[model samples]
Target: MVEALDLALGGVAVGILAWGFERYRTRFVKSDLIIAGALAVGLLIFVVLPGVYDSIGAALNIDGRFVLLSMLAQFVLLAIILHLLSMVRETNARFSDLVRNISADQAPQMDGGERTIFVVIPAYNEGKTITSVVKSLPDTIRGYTLQPVVVSDGSVDDTAENARYNGTVVVEHLVNQGQGGALKTGFQIALEQEADIVVTMDGDGQHPAEELERLVSPVIDDEADYVMGSRYKGENKTGNGVVRESGIRSFTWLINALTKSEITDCTNGFRAIRASGLEDMKLTEERFSAPELIIEARKNGLRIQEIPITIEERQAGETKKPQLMYAIGLTRAILATWIR
Candidate 1:
């Protein structure tokens, strides 16, 4: 017997079909028409075969068939959302690649040196400490000529100008793409200039310029392909208190477990990698890329080592990383890197 629901569904389906036909003929929107038709047909099917869903649900041992329909609808919506997100991510990647190329092209031509090392200091509005950081770097490390590439990642302050005035290589981004994006530009520059070792340090002055050699020593000496400067392994003068410290240790433990590598500090930005090692690694995270780099290096079979290094308090502006955002970003980086 035909029920009230069947009659209502039938009327709705017929109305949708007529409306879709009229809209398609007038507006000529294929997508709209297709969607309207599909939905109308689904409703019509439900109205014609009222007990079909229950029969199929019973066969499949589903407890609630109506709930199954709702879940399927939600799944479709999620799939569409995920597909859109993927497109946005791809677009971002393309834009970042363009910036990196432009930055590398505009970077000052390195002097005629047989071997070179690029110390990439990524800063955003770090004007106060930028100049001092550039001045403190050694002229050479283990005979490799030092090339300080200060990437002012869309800084609105005097960061780029200060570094440029101090006779350091400055790569300025027109838009902020986070530290990872700035470092990626530096890596591109390192590759183009044929650098032997690429050392990455923070521009906020947390990383000591004096310990640069110690950080790059393992990579320079061929002892390891990549090196990380660990505050836990050395002095943590952060003075930001225990919250940050505990978070780092916890994440480090989780990363070590996942990678099966005994890494003391996974969040440390002070790192050195062979130019060739960067070639094998694929890093994507714009903000939380620290773990992404380590994960990629490990995946590519690069021997990784962590050395003791001092991490001082920020010299100027407040920390960009808020606690909640930092935790979420770090977790995202870890899982995304490990799963891939």
Candidate 2:
């Protein structure tokens, strides 16, 4: 009987392994089939053989009826394992999607600048577009010094390798934390590296590296504590078609109206901040809405300025927006920031 219980527990462990396989093993890997075979073989050898005969059963102190009960136990264990696997896979997939979506966002650049600038790019699963973004940075800016950093947010792809090859300070997250989390990490590194000004950009290649100079100009000129890259002020020429342009126009108008701070594009991730102002704010967000950094700066009486910047369509892959969720989240963020 005890031998049958041991066999039952062994089968249960196999069922748990099957659950993990279903959750993380790639679809091409048929861990489920291997798990089933293992369970069957284990049960047959350890539990079934000993219970087949009274002579051997008594010698082993395992009853035939108890072995049957243990078989039922194995079935229950399998069912529980399957349920757990489904839940784990669903949760992990959702979290992975959130980080991937954030990583695919693009950044803007300054043409030429006279102030020291550090660009922090937060990336996740941006293997296809990072090379172009990194290579596109101008070798020199007239008025600003530049350091481009690519923060790989635990990408399953080769984002980090590409960034390193491009000669950027590549920071990697050990796990998929989120965009806001990645930005904080990048900023801290920039601080330690002693950057006077920091520019935050997305990794999906939506930003023009040349535009960074303009975004940082206000800070270098002492006109603003922070400078935001606004798509509205520049000539209406964008690689984005009419539909995307129209959407951006509507969002810009909404941001200007609600914030009363005259931000032409609050959702745009491309922006430059002075070291002092950025160091003062507590960057708590761990997702895409690091928008809180700007809001908090403004609340603390830090000057905010916007500069005209050109926008471009992604070099490859698709936009990560699932639907109207980004818009809805923006509205909530605006309200939250206003109250704060």
Candidate 3:
């Protein structure tokens, strides 16, 4: 009766495994399917040849099938561990490739004539909204020649093409190096072009192009070396959930307390800076660049100001950032920047 019950359970397990494979075949990659298939084959062998286990136990001088089963389990576990190690190695290889693509020769140059305003936009996989972001920029800001430079950070889509279509200069990375790396590249290009003022904004269409003048106003007047946009200070809209909203407020308070700066927004990416001031700023954080840049700027005693701005929902694809991970990274960046 015990043997019969074991066989029945094995049959049921095989049926369930087959059902799962059939139901989710499209969700798995070829390698995943191969692993599942190997497991299924092992299960089939165990179910169809129950007596074979006893034969193997006898050959190995074992008393019962339990020892054989344990050996098989160990083998399967080893296979899984080997697969995971391969995955990790592959991921490391891709990251190394990304780092290799970033050029070391970033020397600022001047165009034929002096240009006053340079807009640096760092984008990754923002094919849907990049065109509009580039097009919405004014031909000239407050009589200063406006030049939009789009840095495509290893985008697999048409982000570079769209920016170029809108008559903006576009630079592309072979692989993604995060937002900080992209912005650094953009800043170097802007400085090379001999821009007096450098403006950084999002490519996701959350930042309005109409506010360009206001964002750069303080820098133009020499009242501040850096102007940070503040959603909390002026008329603005926030589409973030309650948790995100709370996180932003908490981080802003912490940054303010540590930096001794009264800026209402610490993480807002919409901001402007004098090119000359940024010459001394050495940025290193790839993903958490916003906070690091702010902390570094504050430490260097560069004049900082805050102005009211608006942030809206992304116009295209879902946000690439995972909220919890982003907050954690930002927190670490803030602490690291403050200490260093």
Candidate 4:
């Protein structure tokens, strides 16, 4: 009777081993099928073979000390095996949940009807190209709704006045605070108006307005929290001019190298970001160095992606590259962020 009971208990361990093998077979196969196979063999060696040996020992009246020790060994082995099986199952389940949540959270939510997108063009003396850039964007990206805003960076020229006339909501900075400040103003206004997505493009018209779809698709499809247009991603490449282009490439290379990240066209100002992603970005710089924005996004654990975009020559305006102190200030800020 005692022998029969021991065999029944042994069957329970075998049953648990079988259940674990079948349940986690796919995961085990990923690591090594041989390890999984070894588990099966070990189960037979420790549980099934032991039960047979114990039955013969009990029939021959084996010593009481040996019998007790054998029972204890069986219990300990069963417990350890079961614990290891549970751990693998739990770990895999946890990893799957994290991936699903991250993927789901990044997707852009669609509106029931026409969703409003506010395009913010931060302009600083971009009078010549402002009009063309304003007129170039179509009514929609494929079929999403859109609205454009021209945030004048205290342009001394007629950029602010012209943007208002070209069917845009023009906001003016009393004093030039730089591109980052202009973007902050535009984003705040968009958020106030309940915009679904807010796009920031260069007022200098270097961004091809016709290809706005590429900038907005990831947001519409829910792939990323922010999407920056990459002139290096595809055949579509545009820039302010040769000198400006070289500067852009050099700065981009510097950033990519420091971050150990791939940023094909880092300096392209053509980007579309979710209103949520801009919720708390301070954007303190009043100059042209906006790499701080990317740094901020990374620090906040935002999921950022890039889309290939066509870079175009400035349609009708002068370039606004910072010459001396502004460059120095930007370098200082970037280094500080790295050290921090």
* TM-scores for all predictions: 0.83, 0.61, 0.69, 0.61
What is the per-residue lDDT of model 1 for residues 41-97, given as tens digits with 9 covering 90 to 100?
867777787577677777888765566556656876786578669778889899988
lDDT (tens digit, per residue) of candidate 3 on 72-96: 8799899889999989968865664
User: Which is the leading candidate under TM-score?
Assistant: 1
Q: What is the lDDT of residue 181 in candidate 3?
A: 81
Off by over 4 Å in 1: 1-71, 109-113
- Report lDDT per candidate: 0.86, 0.70, 0.81, 0.69
Lowest summed lDDT over 10 consecutive residues: which window, candidate 1? 63-72
lDDT of 4 by residue, 142-223 (tens): 6667788887776899997777654577767666666766776677677766788888888877787777887888888889
| Residue pairs whose backbone atoms clash in candidate 4 | 107-222, 108-222, 177-286, 178-286, 237-311, 238-311, 238-312
lDDT of 2 by residue, 1-340 (tens): 7766766767776675666566555564455556555555554555556444445556667667456546656885888599679878678757754543444332223334244577889888899999888888875566556778888888899998888754577766768777777887667766655678988888888788878777877888789988888777764344665655666567656656655567766667888888878777765456645457767777778899878887676777777664467656655665666575
Answer with 1 or 3, whichever has the higher lDDT.
1
Measured by TM-score, how close is model 1 to the native structure?
0.83
Question: What ordering of candidates by lDDT runs from best to worst?
Answer: 1, 3, 2, 4
